[model samples]
Target: MPFASRRPRSYASPRALPSARARARHGRNGRSPVTGPDLPLAHTRLDAFEATVQATADYLQDLWPDELAALRIEVLPMPDQPPGVSGVARWRVIPQHRLVVLYRIPIERMSRLHREDDWHRRLMVESCVFRAVGELIGKDPWDLAPDRFRHW
Candidate 1:
C-alpha cells in the first residue's frame, strides 16, 4: 500500500529555539504548533545565556583589549540532536587567537523540576551544548585553566 512505506515528516531543529527570530515568534504566549508552554520557557532561558555570554565577552575584552578584535562570540544550533522536556543551548566561543575560553552550563533548577521521563532529554541537551562548544573552541569548559593574558 502507498501509505505502508510512507516516512514520517521531520521537524525544524530544536536548537533553533534560541534564535532571535524564534524568540520573537514564541513571545510571552509560548504558543506554537510545534512547541508548547514548556519549550517556550526553555527558549526564554536563552536570555540568561545571552547575558552570561555578553558578560564573559566583556570580561575577555577587558583582559585582552589588544586582541579584542580577535575575540568574538558565535552561536550555532545543534539540530541533529533529539528533543523533549530538555534542550541544550550550545554555541561557539571562537577567538582569532589560538587561545580562547569556553563555558558550558545547565539549568539545574529546570532539570530538577522536569518529569522523570524527561531526564534523558535534559542530559542529552546539556551534554550536546557542552560538547559542541568544546569541539569548536578546541578546549573544554573548566576553571582550572590559566588566562591567556594576565597583563591587564
Candidate 2:
C-alpha cells in the first residue's frame, strides 16, 4: 500500500518518533527531555509536613501489596530546612524499581550521593519513597505532594 492511500494514516509508526521536531529535540534515540515541570508537585505547608506524609501513606495504602500494607512509609522532617525547600512534602513510590534514593539526588550529583549540597546537606528528609515517586511521575517529590489532599 502507498503512504497516502492507507485508510488510517498514523502520525508515526511504532518504531518511529512522535515527529521529526520531537526527534530533533529528544535526539536520535527518541528520549524526551526531563525537567522540573515534569515532576509531580505535592504541596503542603511547613507545619503540615507530617500530614502530607500521612496522606502519602493513605495513597500508598490504596496501592499496597498484601504483604506491605502494614509497612509504614517513613516520614521525617528536615530540620533547618533549606531556604527554598518545599513547604511540606513526603514521598510515595511504586515499589518495583527501587530507585527512590537514587532518584532523589539531582542528576548532576547522582554519581556522588555522599557529596552533600551546602544548603541541602543539613535540611533534607531524604527517603527512598520520594526518589521512587520522582521516577514514577518524572518529577521531584516536593512537586508531587503539592498540598495535603483535601479529601484525604
Candidate 3:
C-alpha cells in the first residue's frame, strides 16, 4: 500500500541504548571522554609541586604546631636570578612574611630527571620545601622533627 506521507517510518529495536563500556568510554554528548583503566590523568607540574609543598608543610605543622602561624610557603614560576642562572628555591624572612619560595621551572627540571614518577617528583618537591623552610626557621631539616623522620 502507498503511504499518505513522504516521511520514512521509524523502527524500534532491542538494542536502543549504548552498551556500558561505550557509555563509560564516551561520556554524554561531547565532554572530555573518560579513559578506560589503561589510561589515567596526572596533575600538572605546578599543581603537584604545590601539593607536595602543602603536604610537607602539614607534616611540619603537626610537629611544631605553634610555629605554623608564622611560616608561609610560596611557589614562583622562576627564581629572581642575577642573570641567566635560575636557582632552585629562595627564602625571604621578613617581619610578618617569612616566605620560602620554590622556583617551579628549576624544580621541574630536577623532577624530570626521575622520568616523571609521581612519588619521586613529590618527594623531590617536598625535600626542596623542607630544606628552604628549615633554612628560614634556622633549623636543620633532619632536626625539624627527628622522631617523625627517622628514615629520612
Candidate 4:
C-alpha cells in the first residue's frame, strides 16, 4: 500500500552537475552553440587581413609558379628590429631564405586610405603582399598581376 501511494521517480540522474570551469573547458566556451568554427560571420580584422594576403599571394603564385614555388609568406604583428631610414617596413623580403615577412600592424594601421572600409582595407593588404612578392623576385608590383588590371 505504501509503495502504491508513492510518486514515480524522474528519469534524470541524481549525480551532481559538472562545475562551471569544467563545463566551460569542455563546452563551446564563448562561441554560439548553434554555429561551427568555419562560420564566415566569426572572421575578425586580422583574419580578413591574412586572408587578403593569402589570396593575393595565391593569385601571384598561380601566374608565376616558378618564381613563387619556393617562396614562403608570413605575417607578424610587428617587426623585431628598429625602423630603417625610410620608416617602419610594412614587409621584409629575404631572398636568401625565400621568406617574406609582413608586419600586420604597420600595414593595417599606417596606410592612408581614402575610404575607411572593408574593401579599401583588403586592397591595402593585397597591395602590401604584391609589393613584398615583387621585392622578393625583383619585379614591379604592377607587373605581378598585369592581366588582372588590363581593361579593354
- The number of the candidate with the highest TM-score is 4
Better of 1 and 4 by lDDT: 4
The 10-residue segment with the lowest total lDDT in model 1 = 1-10
Candidate 1, 1-152: lDDT as tens digits: 01111234466636445666655764663436566555653444344444444555555445445544454443332323455736653333344432223233433333344455444544444444444434544556332124532457
- Best of the two (1, 2) by lDDT: 1
* Best-to-worst ranking by lDDT: 4, 3, 1, 2
Question: In lDDT terms, how accurate is model 1?
Answer: 0.42
lDDT of 4 by residue, 103-136 (tens): 9899999999999999999888988888888999
By TM-score, is 2 or 4 better? 4
* Top candidate by lDDT: 4
**Residue 98 C-alpha lDDT in model 4:** 86
129: Cα error in model 1, Å: 12
Each prediction's total of clashing residue pairs, residues at least 3 apart in sequence or on different chains, is 0, 15, 0, 0
Q: Distance from true position, residue 76, model 4, in Å?
A: 0.2
lDDT of each: 0.42, 0.41, 0.64, 0.80
Give the runs in model 3 whose Cα sits over 4 Å from its true position: 1-42, 84-96, 111-116
- In candidate 4, what residue range of length 10 has the lowest lDDT sum? 1-10
Residue by residue across 22-128, what tens digits does model 3's lDDT show?
A: 66655655334377556875566666666677778888877877765666766667666566655544433443566666676777674555465777777777777
Flag regions of model 2 displaced more than 4 Å. 1-46, 78-152
